[model samples]
Target: MEIRLITADDADRIMPVRAYAFDATPLTPQRAEELVRYMSFRLQNTTLAAEEDGEVLASVSGIPMRQNLRGVVHPMLGVAGVVSNPLARRRGHVRTLMHDLMRRGREQGRPLSVLYPFRSGFYARLGYLGLTAAKTVTLRPEALASLLTVDLPGEVRLRRIAEGWEDVLALQDRFLGSRHGFTEFPEYRRHQPRDDDEHWLVTAHRDGRVVGALPYRITEYGGELAGGVLLHDGAIARALLLRFLAGHADQVQTITLSVPPAERPEQWSTDFAGTIASTVAIPHPAPPMVRVLDLPALTGLPAGEARVTITVVDDALLGGDWTLDGAGGALTVTPGASASEVRLTSAALSGLVYGALGPEEIVARGLGAVPAEAWDGISTLFPRADPWVYLDF
Candidate 1:
């Protein structure tokens, strides 16, 4: 089978493979046409397919986006829509496509590739390590009663997403400035809600500037109100958003907010702990995974003061001995001298660099080997922090 970039003409053939892999419903002629249109729209991204003798077997798409890595923004390739024909199973077509995508991403100067996997283990073999998933805090709207009583300076307004799209994007860019692993959605995706009237953009404005915004959807009356991309500038903006959500107490029984793993909703209100019904720390069954595509481009990453040399094993893309020197709060990687101190796989290295796994945890999980003397340097260089991706795609 030959792997090549998928064009508009191949959309119909690949649609059936994707439908069989992801959707169980029968693909009637109308449904197939609709899916073809959708696939055609998504072709703006870099999509690839494996074909042999005029038949498409498997396909994948990579979206060029940006992600924050420890306060530094870097280009990232978002992988999605991986699917294979039933007859082509276990033929390694998907693996070939993924390798080509990673190569293209690295050539384009993107340092990272992230994806929400259908099966975590399947991508784990390709050097992708799991990052912390977003936390879903489920609680009754009454839990935010205290926020309503606060005399905040901002006024919260509910508007359609199109009316406040620019403000929302600006607010989100500010929010992502300090967040690690948070990725911004592509421009095409940002405008998706313009056509959907059901979506609501709740904004908190102070001094005629947008301080906070929460885009949410409430499908049915007395059901759950689901929040999306919750962004706040400060304490008052957060309080205002919570107060607005509390106003929905009479209409919705429960409010579910998707927050980063580091955020503590229980501390938002004194009665939050008592009123919270359930908290799914990792709401998605398969958390998002990441892989470091261009390691050299990650120079000057903020890190603790330390110097360590390590070897990356079993990584076809980036494998060898390298020295990581993090002194004066900046990391610099160079060729290792002589024998290395630690040895780990590329997945382990990705986890360490992303702050998802500490050096000790890496050792405990058998992902790496660390000598007693190298603990301080390794630990200091790769401190543990919960890396969260706010955007699903």
Candidate 2:
């Protein structure tokens, strides 16, 4: 089928594809249109497709974001409505569409891409690894004690984000600066109006400066979950979290949170003590993937003066690690060689991506090998920060 970029005018055709794909899904026509409207705003990179005969079949689109700190720009492409005609289901339309979208992302210089996959394993094969997780739990506020009692970290204030867009962007930056795996908010999206959910942005200040912030709000369903952006510092993060949970106490019965893999609030939340918990890997990574996309990128990324050559086997693809010339500013990953230092597959790589296990632990578990002393250095390279998504779309 002929695949091509779509424009606002094609919504009629695109909407039907979405409806056909999500017919059994919980999404309604309005929800589908709302999503289409969101995607339409990013006309440049957005894409939609139809069969060779001109029948719409799939679509994907998203805006780009910039982290002023890193001076890097990447678009967060959201893949949606990737449905084929029922008779064309077995055809590789989905795979072909995904490849086209990924190529488009790379062509536009977006090193990182994300999407809430219809099937986890399906995306894994496409090199999209599970990075972070979110825990959705149901608990009566009265059944759980008030999560916060002590004074907040600073001149803590809660206000509606809709009142001012500048305040929302400032708070979002503060949160993303200290966390990894969290996508940066794009300038356009910052001012882009939304109506699906009401957001209350809370901030804590010390000495008249904002130290932490969280964007959240309670719903009529008698449930409240940590939403939108979140700043660094677990204590301040927890404070904002507790305040949100506390406000819903007695009236709310479930408290869900989309958190960084390393920031496990359930472990520290007095409200959740003794409560059984479940978690799903979030769309973002707990510790964002750090591939040596360019050798120069890694050289300047603070690998430290100490260095060693360790072999890593990627079961997902090629195996064997190359000589890492820290002093020479080079990395040569190769395959098939005599015995070397460490060995691990892509599955084990996931463990390292998250803080689930350290280098030493991985080696002990027969996943990989590393000098005992180098473990600290290796861990330092991958900070254990919570991964958060700036936008669900």
Candidate 3:
């Protein structure tokens, strides 16, 4: 079996496979052609793929993401899509495709490849580890009545995010910037953001200044018990819950919000009857895959720091643990740390960066260990930003 790059002409073969694999709405001929065209324009060839006999078996794409190191922004590839045809399932085609993609990404000077996986376990064998933990909670209206009854001095407004809403966008960026596990979605692509039929984007403005805001979209089934909300936090994540619930009180009896595993909303709201479900697995307990194409460049990320050494254990093929030294005038990562500052697998490192696992807990769980003094520094190096990838592509 041979895997190669996917060209625009190969859409006929690839689309059928994708439609079958996803088992969703069929990809029309025109749509497939358009998708390929868009992919060609947006992604570099290094991020393309196909399988045996020129058959488009599996595919993935990534963009060069830059990080500020010292004063420079180093590039990394944020990969998405790991689609494989059901007919080709269990054939290891996806693995081969990803491995090659990682090599190509690295060759192009991208030090790392990041992706949000459908199944954390499924990707580990390919060297991708769980970095983020998604939380899903079902909200009961009766339980939320008290929190909802509190009259807010501000007026609540609901509307689709539109052009010139710089205040809302700016407020969102400011709120999510300091947060861990979050990524900024550039303004250019907001034309058709997904809202799952019942998306609620409510903003609370007080005294003519944007203060509280929430971005929520829901999925409905036959009734309220089945349908729930997929909520992400903005400035007014907690505040908008009551009003949002009232809007859907009859339609969806329960509203669920996916949040950071560490954030405890129960403390803020009195109604805490619902159970918290983890969207992805914890401690990963799966094979972790990741590739750092350029070490010096990868270490020069813009989480902002004067100079520091961060130890990483990345076993995503061309993987190893080393002291990423950015501790001088120039940002540099060298492989000469005898003390093994922090020891964990590549998967563990991804999980750590994604805020999936706490350093202290990792040590307790036997996944890896870090000295007490080093914990604080490690946290600072890989701060949390709400690990939200704006586009699912």
| Best model number under TM-score | 1
TM-score of 1: 0.93
lDDT of 2 at 285: 24
Model 3: residues >4 Å from true position, as ranges? 7-9, 25-47, 63-76, 107-112, 148-153, 161-172, 184-190, 194-200, 206-237, 240-252, 279-294, 300-321, 325-332, 337-344, 352-393
TM-score of candidate 2 on Cα atoms, chains taken together = 0.69
Residue range 323-357, candidate 3, lDDT tens digits = 54334333345665454667775555555544455
Q: How far is candidate 1 from the true structure (C-alpha RMSD, Å)?
A: 2.4
Model 2 lDDT at residue 50: 51
User: Which digits, one per residue and each the tens of the lDDT, describe model 1 over residues 130-184?
Assistant: 8765666788889888787788786988888888778787876875777788788
Candidate 3 minimal-lDDT segment of 10 residues? 283-292
Instruction: Flag the better candidate by lDDT, 2 or 3.
Output: 3
Q: Who is ahead in lDDT, 1 or 2?
A: 1
Q: Estimate each model's TM-score.
A: 0.93, 0.69, 0.69
Which stretches of model 1 miss by more than 4 angstroms? 273-284
Order of candidate numbers by lDDT, starting with the best: 1, 3, 2
Candidate models: Cα lDDT each: 0.83, 0.52, 0.54
- Per-candidate Cα RMSD to the true structure, in Å, reads 2.4, 5.7, 5.7
